[model samples]
Target: MEYDVVVLGAGPTGENVADRTRAAGLSTAVVEGELVGGECSYWACMPSKALLRPVIAGSDARRVPGLRQAVGGPLGTEAVLAHRDEMTSHWKDDGQVSWLDGIGARLYRGQGRLHGPRRVVVEGPEGEHHVLTARHAVAVCTGSRAALPDLPGLNGARAWTSREATSAHAAPRRLVVVGGGVVGTEMATAWQGLGSQVTLLVRGQGLLPRMEPFVGEHIAKSLTEAGATVRTGVGVAAVNRPDPGGPVTVVLDGGELIEADELLFATGRAPRTDDIGLDTVGLQPGSWLSVDDSCRVDGHDWLYGVGDVNRRALLTHQGKYQARIAGAAIVARARHCPLLETDRWGAHAATADHDAVPQVVFTDPEAAAVGLSLAQARAAGHRVRAVDKDLAAIAGASLFVDDYRGRARMVVDLDRQIVLGVTFVGPGVSELLHSATIAVAGEVPIDRLWHAVPSYPTISEVWLRLLEGYRDGADGGDGTDDGADGGDGTDGDTDGTDGRGGRGQGG
Candidate 1:
């Protein structure tokens, strides 16, 4: 069978691309071997967040003075597990399949691989073979899979990857999490909150090595306080599980052995390109595909690589953004229309992938950031300055919790006086990230940002404090200048109190 577009993965990226192409009057067919909605729908994002939301809510309730004693108990494990199952649709894809039907895209339930230029071959579960040809383009949105380290005896140990960690029916009593990246930290947080003794093992000096150093420091402190053992600067040398159903023993580099009911290796991710027949198209298998701003594969105008396979931003939202751009580009090509203005922020350009990618880590004291960190900005040769503020000083934070422990920072590009990046680590700060994303993506000037006032007595007022800090620093003096409010330049009480003397502050 032939169509105007054939998307080789029915994940979020592929679904979005198919939707766009279908909307543009193209005949699109999406192929997948697994559930239609893919990883984010069943395993990674949705199910994980479903499990964590109640844990976070319980923590939030316990933080309030009047609610503390009432909600100090452990999470209801059975209920949480059931809720997670509901969120993942009990691992069913019927709803997603119905949505594809509504979108006018044909669905092929099989493993899809490139056979040749604009050609795909699907090998069905029943051993039937089918060929699909694309008249306009073929998009590879196969995404990625968790990459585990090659330690001795690891594979046979039945180690938990992000898949198992998120989808496990029951939480392990003792969970040993390996790696300090998002998957490791978040799973540790979720399992620990759900009554597991979680020990996080990281070879690096801290968690979240990609973000600002302080962000990791804050999260590590909170995790430790919450009764999770966080071990840094340690690598696993080997693993042994003589009995498949018994506990696994992890041997560390310095000869220390740790036993746990479950061991999860959240090391990293590898592109899912190993068996998609890239060799037939002159591209190496297992290599991340290179794509232009319009998501067209390098040197192949009819080939597009959207999502994690493209090696652009690995986040789901970013993949959808690329899908939109790629769909538009494909439609333009199909119609024989001259491509117009494919520059940054153009209708068919994925400019945000490079400069304005935003991510939120939904651990306790949610960590969110957008754009480049201070070090990244400096390394990129931008004249930048970083401004910091303790989130506890924000009035809304204190009102939200007695001892709200968090911090916020903004990296400013001095040459253009625009925000280069913004990082927020605190309770309920995830909602504040889009503002930073907009500022960075739009290149809003510092002087202009000063006029955009944050509401008084709100957590967002931290924006005002940040801008004030920048102004004070730009004036070349200590941040003690008197202001119209008859106060020092410091926005909040230095002693970490909300000035009401209700409770002592320390997150």
Candidate 2:
């Protein structure tokens, strides 16, 4: 098959790229090895979030009518499974395929490997192989897969990565999560809420270590209260599972053995670019293809890389942003103009990404934040100012519940009077994050932010308190600091998570 653009993965990013190219009057072909919607749709984000959605909405398999006996609370197992199946279309690949065809993009159902720059070989289902050539460009958007850690006795055991956990019809009774990051926390909370006894083991001292201490503290407390035993600053020294349904006993470094029905390693992910002909395409770092600022691959200007394969921020939204930039950049290059870079807008230019990428941990009393933390700003050579507030003091807190327990903080550049960081933890506080995200992204001056009034008798009103408190000092002055702001978050942006740039993001 010949086309102007051949997108190598039909995930959201690839779909977005192909759509953008088609809209620009380019003939696009999207090749897929498996499900067209890729990992995010079938396994990662969609199914995982769907599995946890009902629990957050106060719906669970143990809570439905006539199915109450199967669970301690009230859910119809059949109905819950029905909902999941409906959400995933029973693992059907048709929705994505139809969406591709609807957009006028030809779809190939086979594994495609790069044969050369702007060239690929497709191993088809019927055992036929075809060489597909693209006239303009080829975008790599293969995404990533669950990473397995090298642990003693962990091999050949009945284990579940995110894929199995998200799609499993029945929950494991005793689940041991091997990582203490966001994925582990969410899965632990979800399964525990659905009646699984969860034990989370972390190599760090706290949960959500990437955020402010206040945020991490609250999440840890919530997770602990939710009945998930969180063991921090510890790791697995050994693990043994004799057979399926047998106990998974994990021995800690200090000689403690923790047993569970199943072990889920939410350690991280490995980009799925292996054996896909990256070596034939010249050089880059790691196993990922190195791309320029405009998402153009190293040697071949027409070839591009997006999503996890580029080794940028490994988040779904970040992947989408890359796709948008690459698509736009391609058009710009065709017009004989310079392509946009990461921080400047033009073709495929997404500059704010390095400075601002926001996400939220959806546990109860959620934790959310954006931008550089205090230490990060300081390390980056910016004068840093950090202020914190507890939810109990603010007027909004008293209104939400008499005893709402949570905290918030904002980091400031003393010289610039612009926000450097923001962190919020409390019920409903997640929605208020955009103001902070905008502040950090826009570098909005403190004076202008003061006019952005938060509604009254709500958590967001704490913004007023924060700005008022900044006074003379919280923005980085001597003693004019104000710290009276606190709330459950009456802010209007949807719920969110963070870093001192790389420091915050690495956690």
Candidate 3:
């Protein structure tokens, strides 16, 4: 089979690439080894969020005066699991396949690898071989997989990765989660609400070490208050499960043994490029494919790497953003267009991956942030200031839920007077992240942001509070002005790459 574009992996990243190419009249073929919709659909984003929604909803209700008494009961775990199954189409890909068919792109159900430059060989399900040649480009969107630690007995211990953690039939009586990133923290929150006694172990000083320090502190306090033991500065030594269907024993680095019905290793993610024939192209196997700002492979003009494999930003949305840019770049090159919109925030540039990547962790009190954190902005050598607000102090927050507990922060570029970053942690802060994302991405001036007034009484009022604090020079914690400490500001990161650490499972 010969096509204008050949795409490996049919995840959201791959799907979007094919979508853009097909729309531009380019014949595109997509290959997949698993479900068509990929990790975000079946395991990571969709099913995981389905399990967390009810848990968060119930938590939100309990905080309300009249609703508190009504929701004071155990959650219906069966219904939640059933709903999760439905959300993932019971682990089927018929709907996604149909959508792909409608887009006029051909789908190959098999493992695909690069046979040579611009050449792909797919091994079909029945061991049949199909050779596909790409005339324009070959895009790699294979994404990533869970990276388990090198520990004893882990292979036979039946330990859970993000896949098993999201698709489990029922919550275990006791669950021990290692790694305090998004996957571990969110799963701990979900299972704890679903009647599991959860013990979360973090090797770092606290959970979500990539974000602001307070984010981990606040989430740790909330998780502990909700009946889960949140331990920090801990590492797993080994795991043991002697019986086929029995409890697993986790040995800590400090020689402490803890037993749990199931153990989850949400360590990190490894790029899925191991067996994709990288060696055929003179690149090392099991290595991340580096790409330029346009998602094109660094050395090969005709090769592109989109999504998690590029290691730009591991979040699903950021991957899709890169997909759109890659698709546009491919189309432009194919048309012999001399001028590709390669400038920052241009049509063919994925600038958001660097400065405006937004992420929302769907825990009880949702943690959301976009752009730079205070430390990040300062480290990037931006003349910046940080302002904060207590959500409970906002009038809208009190009306939204009695005794509302949350915090908000805004980091501003002092010289430019534009918002550098924003962080919100509260019951429904996830919905408020996009507004902050726009501010950071657009580089909206603080004076102009003040004109974009927030509504009278909503969680969004936190925006107004943030702006007021910035204007009044109120640091929210200390009344002192926290300014830059001798930054050269010469080596600005030109590539649109967010320096945030990658914690995949599609984030």
Candidate 4:
């Protein structure tokens, strides 16, 4: 079978790619070995958030004065899991498949591998082989999987990765989570709230090392306060499980041993390119595919890499963003039209992946940030200022959560007077991140931001406080001008754990 586009992996990224290509009247085919909706829908984003919402809601309820009494009991774990299962369509992809069919994209059910340039060979579940050829472009969107550490006794041990952590039938009595990234912290929060005694072991100095130093501090404090053991500067050396489904014994680097009913290695992500037959196309089978800004593979005009497989911004939303760009580029090239708007913030270019990528880590006190951090701006040689405001000072925050503990930081480019990045680490702050993303990506001027007033008495009021602080500090005009805005644009987008983005992508 030949198509204008053949997409490997039917995740959100692949679906969007096929959707766009087919909308452009290009024949598109999508192949998947797992559920059609991919990781975000089945495991990472959707189900995980489903598990987290109740926890967050309960926590929020407890913070409010009158509502606290009603929610003073443990979360119904059975109901929570059931709700999550429902949100994921009970792991069935029928709806997703139907949506694909509606979009006029062919769905090939199998394990697909690149047979050669612009060619994909899929081995169906029953070992049937089907060769698919792409007339215009072959897109690789296999996404990523948990990267387990090479530890002894791990193979036999029934360890939980993100998938198992989110989909388990019941919460374990004790959960040990390794890695301090988004998955580790979020899952730790979810299970701990659902009545599990969570022990979060981090090899680094603190949680969320990629964000501001205070972010890790705040999350660690809250996690500890919530009856979870937050231990930092600890490394896992080995795993010992005598029998499957038995207890897991994790050995630390200094010979310390910890026992848990379940162990989750939220260590990191590895590209799902290993078995995709990349070697057949002269590329390393296990390596990440490099792509240009349009998500097209390097040195291959007919090849495109979208989503986590390309190692570009790894967040699902970012992957979808890349897919749109890739699709547009594909359509433009195939139709012999001028590839206009390939520039930054253009319809055909994914400029947001560079700095305006937004992420929300759904812990009790959500952590969200976009654009650059103070350290990132300094390293990038931008003359910037970091202005911080205590969210407790905002009246809306106090009304939202009694004794609200959160901080907001705004990083501004001094020379240009434009906001480089913004971060809000507190309860209900996730809703405030998109404004920051717009400010950074649009390069909105600080003086202009002062006029874009936040609604009165909302968590968004923190924006006003930050702007006032920035203005007050600037007014002082002391001889020492540390007045550079505080905020850091992460080197990699999506908190470095969820999504991966490379420098370039092509369609």
Identify the superior model by TM-score, candidate 1 or candidate 4: 4
Q: TM-score for each prediction?
A: 0.93, 0.87, 0.94, 0.94
lDDT of 4 by residue, 1-507 (tens): 999999999888888898899999999999999888787777777778888999999998898999989999999999999988887778777777878888899999999999988899999999999999999999999988988889888888889999898889999999999988889999999999999999999988778776877887899999999999999989988999897767999999999999999999898788999999898888998889998889888989899888888776678878888999999999999999887898888888888888788888899899998887788778888877788788898899899978889988887788888888787889999899888988999998888888898888788978777777778777433111233333242322132222111101111
Against the true structure, what is every candidate's RMSD? 8.2, 6.6, 4.8, 3.9
Ranking by lDDT: 3, 1, 4, 2
Model 1 regions more than 4 Å off: 475-507
* Model 2 lDDT tens row, 107-172: 887888888778999889998898889888889988777787888888867678877877778877
Give Cα-based local distance difference scores for all models.
0.84, 0.71, 0.84, 0.84
Instruction: Give lDDT tens digits, candidate 1, residues 1-507.
Output: 999999988878888899899999999999899888777787787778887889888888899999999997788999999988887778887777878898899999899999989999999889899899999999999988888889999989999988899899898999999988788888988999999999999898888877887787888998999999999989999999999999999999999999999999998888999999999999999999998999999989799999888877777778878888999999999999977959888888999988998988888878999998777776788877788888999999999888899988888877788998898999999899999999999999999998888887789999998998888787432222222111111110000000001110000
Cα lDDT for residue 83, model 4? 88
lDDT of 2: 0.71
Off by over 4 Å in 2: 59-78, 284-286, 340-347, 397-402, 475-507
Stretches > 4 Å off in candidate 4 = 475-507
Clashing pairs in 1: none
State the lDDT at 206 in candidate 2.
69
TM-score quality measure for candidate 4: 0.94
